[model samples]
Target: MDKSPDAYWKATLRLIGTVLVIWFAVSYLAGIVFAPALNSIHLGGYPLGFWFAQQGSIYVFVALIFWYAKKMDDIDREFDVHED
Candidate 1:
């Protein structure tokens, strides 16, 4: 089935929004707001929260970038808008 341009755009925007929200939650909420609680857990001799703040968020961000790209590629294919 084919989707209209408007529908394709809306789907793209929704995907972007969802990815941003996940990024924010990991970067802000986990790294800062819930850091204290997360600190109670240990990861490789360092506090889990500290790890999230110092490295995990960056890792998640990079992973998210790849994930987003792959998802968008799939979306483009679904919408019949993929590049050659």
Candidate 2:
């Protein structure tokens, strides 16, 4: 059975929202609010915030986008939805 355009969009938005929330929370918690505690463990040439701000968070963001895309694709397949 074919799915409606609205269903595909809804699934995409839901994936975006879920991934964004997790990304924001992890980045904020590790980079700022818990920086001091996290600093106790060293990473490369920088402290926790420096590492997160400069490198770690960026890597995570990329992975998050890829993960979201894969997850959303699975969701679409489950619902018989497609962008085209």
Q: Which predicted model would earn the best TM-score?
A: 1
Kindly list the per-residue Cα lDDT of model 1 for residues 2-67, writing each as its tens digit. 499989999999999999899989999999999999999999999999999999999999999999
The best candidate by lDDT is 1
User: Weakest 10 consecutive residues, lDDT, candidate 1?
Assistant: 1-10
- The Cα error of candidate 1 at residue 60, in Å, is 0.2
Candidate 2 local Cα displacement, residue 70, angstroms? 0.4
| TM-score of every prediction relative to native | 0.95, 0.72
| Cα misplacement distance, residue 71 of candidate 1 (Å) | 0.4
In angstroms, how far off is 19's CA in candidate 1? Answer: 0.7
Show model 1 residue runs off by greater than 4 Å.
none
TM-score of candidate 1 on Cα atoms, chains taken together: 0.95
CA deviation > 4 Å runs, candidate 2: 1-14
- Across 1-84, the per-residue lDDT of candidate 2 in tens digits comes to 436787777777888889978888668987778777877777885787668866798899998978987898798777866475
